[model samples]
Target: MTNDDLQFAHDRPIAMQQHDLLDRAGFAQRLALAISSWKNQESLVISLTGSWGSGKSSIKNMALEQLAAIQGSQVIEFNPWQWAGQDKLSSAFFEEISRVVQRKNPTEADKQLAKVLRRYEHRLNAGAAVLSGTAKWAPILLGSALVTTALGSVAEGTAAQVTIWTVSAVSWLGSLAPWLKQAAEWCTKRSKNLDQEAKDSELTLSQIRAELQKLLSARQKPLLIVLDDLDRLSAEQLKAMFQLVKAHMDFANVVFLLLFQRDTVEQGLQRAGFDGADYLEKIIQVPFSVPAISSGQLEAVLSGKLDAILANEQQLQQRFDKAYWDQMFQRGMRPFFGNLRHVYRYASTLAFHCRLLRGTEVAEVNAVDLFALECLRVFAPETYADMPRHKALLTNNEPFARQDEPQRARINQVINHLVFLAPSTHKPATRQLLQEMFPTLDWVFKNTEYDRQTQLRWLINSRVCCDDVFDRYFELSVPEQDVPNSLLHELARRIVDSGPFTTLLASHEEDRQAEILQRLFGLVDEFPLELSLAVVQTLLQAGDVVGRRMSFTNWSPRQQVVRLLRLFLLRHDDEAARSQLVIEAFAVGPGLVVVEQLLASEYALRRKADFGCLDDAGLEQLKSAYLCNLRELAERDPEAFLANPDFESYLYDLNRYGEGGDEGRRWSERHITSTTRFLQFAQTLVNTRSRYSGDGVTHIDEISLHSLDELLGKECCADWVARLDTGELSADASQILGLVKEALAHPARSETAEWND
Candidate 1:
């Protein structure tokens, strides 16, 4: 898995061992023809460009070995980056060529030249004698004499051993020149040559020109010198390396073969002040662009690595479970695109991990496992090191601060893509709302700026994102009518299960919580009950406090949320567990049966009037408020409050509100019917007051059958009306008179309205 465990033997192409090269027959044939052309032409340069790990190195290595078999051809298989200047480049390349030609096709001349070089080097080493027994001046004088005799300088004598070492190196080169010239001549003869001089030291540009003339004496055959693996170079270094190749090597017999990444290479070429297209053509007569591997090819590569564990005799056609494997492949393919390097790495790591855990290698891995592992790998320190922005945003910034634009934008991008590779965001309306939530993200880069279609595409291509569900959610945004369906679902579940959200929602009102409840109901078919519980609880809490009190006159996000909850809860069935919720909605203000629904419900006692949990004091506060407000309304125009359609239900529930069992119900019938009659009487008096005073006034006409007896209870009728009228209603003699009218409106002779008229 690492460089230490595996050695890449240059001669043996790994493609042959692993079946990754199977369907690449077309590519192989193209390479073969290209190689044949090179042999016929005598030299050439070919670029094998592809996404990371598309077998460029493997294929190039294989082709080089095959080319090495040619009789007259000699490949200088060296990376120019190994040295810095033109002199070092020329010296290293020509020296390697000299050594290879001598070793591979050693004539008697080459053999004698080699012998001379070795003997001369030995003699030079022996000649450096340390004069131990001589006087100190004698030793210095001896050193000076040797330096002047050989290296030709008095100053050089002080470092006499170093001077002698330089002489030996020169001698070695002198001895090897014959073979070097012969190889250079052969290269020149086979292709368009640069002229060169016959004398070794005189072999400059003029000599190169002469060499070109000699090479041109025959048909012009281009010689290619390929140098791949430039992808491993640093950005600036890669540009410099290519510049060296362009300036020194792009001439007569040679075309330079340079392989690098698309983006980096283009940028490098641009920095070097060369037209990338023209440079590519000049360096590569026929550039072999390796396209991203297909899904099918990737599968073959994965399967080939596990061939030892799987049956080789069985073809991929029928050996595996087609349906299951297809699903796994689809899932696996989701995270990665055409980057074969990452694919191989992912597969290898997964295979190794699988072997470690299961004791057997798996041919195909589960998509989820692959995805998680890939996530871990990408988020690892080494991978994250390559992405500074992602590192800074994810680590240094907090997503919660609304005004922190940079952090907010980063978090939005992260959430939108579910990863940090691209600046992810939704469309107009949804994006606007999101911006409101995290204001600082408003300036994020637009999607159109990148070549990808969706945020998902950018993430996948960048090898940073892979969650399909998360991607799809952001891809589709609906802010007009409601939050997108997926957003709703995600929010509902998230709010429900989150403790903070639960607490926030629990403190709000009922009607305000109903809207979200409706959304919850819609999703109950898919989301589980536990999740629903969390969501419902949140809505109830929010509605209970902030939501119910919210008014359109003072709109805000908190108020809106409460309003939504109200609409939500109104549609759901009243349950004992939701009893406090029911009261909170009614207690917020008034709406009769709606209020009666809570006041008379069994859960009234269950709601402890503390904070979100309504207790007896809270309920009493609501009761007192309602009564106080009602008394004020009645005094102004008693008919107005009593005329409300729900008045009867309100009185009925109030009479039976805290009573338990049938006897309580009987008392409720008696008292509730009487209260209704009293209100009706009050309405009539208000109507008469209006008619007599020639001013408009409201009144109630309906009376119940049990009212007469309650009004005639000796102290009850006059005492109650007089108390109400003299106290809160003292200024409204007309309202008191209306109450008397309502009591008198019932048949005086009747035992009670409950019996008959």
Candidate 2:
């Protein structure tokens, strides 16, 4: 079979037949020697104690295998937990011993041994029968005696009472005589049987021991009985098994190997009301606690499992070098290796994800980072949850000012909790390790300066562990039939080839098309300049299929295109390049959406305390470009521009006066220069209104008056005044002129006079 066909065997605890992880400590050989040296002696109980998954069972199996190779040794395997609810633990154990002994030596002496074992069984059964009889009759007999005594106490001084009592006593005696006689006969028979049984049991014990001694002497090998999974038994059953082995089952030439996790078994014993340590000490002659696996051994086993799972995947090997693996193992996975099952769990998780993402053309994902993440996912799930939630911070992409203090503190709490939950020796190292893997965490939690170089190196080497890659991983991890990776790959290829994105969208269902578009949207952020341009162009071209008005999250396809193009353009410092991209986007459709997006970015920059990384000149250039694009859209399609919902909002922004400074003066000057178009648009509104008669108001009158008021102090106000004086203005404009004159005549009082009123 191929190596790939070979299942990841270490996914579970290594079984006894599999000695791969067992031989590392040479436990089998050492234990075998210990057992071999105890030749035909009195019963020896050897307890292998370790934490769960610490290779106790594996060691026991190895030792048993070693014993199997020895001459004249007989091994009996018993699982007390399996027989737990089926029978009494002691009976099941003794029955197993008797069966094993019979199977080992089926001769005339063996028949005698069997007879002795039967006598022992009978002795236990007879005692149990006596106890059962007493439990059954004791309550009934006591109740009857209490009733008779109460009657005797109450029976007072009258002849009728005496006669009644006498009759009742007679009747009771007549009824009780038969039962008493039966009880007497039963006790007599039972007493006789007990005496005979005692004599037989004593003789049987002698013969059984003698026969065992002879059989063992002739064979020259000790009997090895391996009892495993005692921890799985209930508390009562575990205690009974221990008592049975310690009290009745101890025989010469016999060795009992009890495999258990010390703490779990001890807790069970304590809960069962026994002094666990003292009780175990009395029963276990030789206690061998399996030493922890060394770091070197753990590393070897983990690396071997990784190699097996990653075989034939050369790209992963190239990306995940020895140094990378070492860093992840030492930092993230090392602490988990106290138990070998942890190694299997993490490796299996990694292998599963690797196989999932194997041939897909995903973003560059470092194998070590994936493995480290899987370690967190498996061992520290709360911490793993924070990885995705605070991904931008962890990857050093989030701005310092934007970092959530509570979220940062929460992440620290999770890390500290994990460290505190770890072994004491490992706490410091674990904290350091997590800090190294996520350096931004050091900055957030420890207030240490972020190591940009180190973080950048990790980003370059292991992008998959970060936020963007994680998003993509989850996107691709879904079934191909559901998400269709091949279709996404095809879309990417077509985008590079400048193929029609609309054609691609037309082929899929609406929801599937949306999924493809969203995937492409994320890809735009990851792709390079050329590929990003191709993606934006595809989205623009797909307007036909997605429809010009098709909106998601309240954004049209054109708006989304504008959003992506703006992000792509900002990456380039070359103004000419950005302008060219803007022009190309504007050349398609009316490009009003692009203008809106640019204005939004400007407002965002204006709100930043330090303008982020952009200087005053860069900010000016962006704002200028925004206005220039808006002017182009207005000049190209004035009606369409006026009809836009943001048209009034844009005018308001242009007329806005900034707070004091050189910047404020510059903004005022720019607003004055930009009002020429505003005056012309105001004139259109004035002309649209008919001559007003009486004092009736109209929509055009309100529009004209509001526009004229907005231009009151600007350079465009004079042009409107000249129009009113020359009679070129309509009656509505003339009315606004009268209001302006009134305002000028009485500055404060005229302002209070409502023209519409």
* Reference-based TM-score of each model: 0.36, 0.58
lDDT digits (tens) for residues 1-757 of candidate 2: 3624534445454445565554533776678778777775678899888777788777766666666666435677889987744235556665776687678546765555556565666655555665655455454345466324423432222334434443454456566655544543444445555556656566554565565556554445676788998888888888878877876444666788899988888889999999988889989988988876777788788778888766745446655667766766666567766667877777766766776655445324566666666765676565555545556655556554445677677667766765665456555655665665665565576677645344434444444534435454444354433444345555656764434555776676654565455545444434566655555455445543453334323455445455545555567777566555554544553444445455565567678743322345544565565566555654577556555555554554455522231332232234433333434444333322333568873533333334344533433455545555754655655665655554444555433323321
- The global C-alpha lDDT for each of the candidates, from Candidate 1 onward, is 0.41, 0.58
Model 2, residue 409: displacement in angstroms?
6.4
RMSD per model, one decimal: 19.4, 11.8
Q: Which 10 consecutive residues of model 2 have the lowest summed lDDT?
A: 657-666
Task: List runs of model 1 lying over 4 Å from the truth.
Answer: 1-19, 39-43, 68-73, 84-87, 107-199, 202-205, 208-224, 233-256, 303-333, 355-367, 375-418, 421-757
Model 2: pairs clashing at backbone N, Cα or C within 3 Å: none
Candidate 1 residues 1-757, lDDT tens each?
Answer: 4312432212233444233353554565456445545432323556677756566666665555444444223344667667664434445554553454358666665454444333322222222222211222343334334323432322223344434444543454565455434432333332221111112224345554444434422322334456766766554656555555655442344445566556567666667677766666675556767655676766665555444322321222122444534543454333343445544555555443433222112212222333333333432323223333343343223334444466556566664543333223212322222222221232353321222123322222211132221222122222233322333434545564444654544443444343434333333333343343444455444433433322323443334444344344444454333444544444443333233333333244455532322345545555555444444443465455356544444444434432342322343234334444554544432221111235653433333324423323423554556655554433445545554546545445222332110
lDDT of 2 at 458: 46
Q: Which stretches of candidate 2 lie over 4 Å from their true place?
A: 1-19, 22-26, 33-38, 69-71, 82-87, 104-111, 141-218, 231-243, 246-250, 263-283, 303-329, 345-442, 446-757
Model 1 vs truth, CA RMSD: 19.4
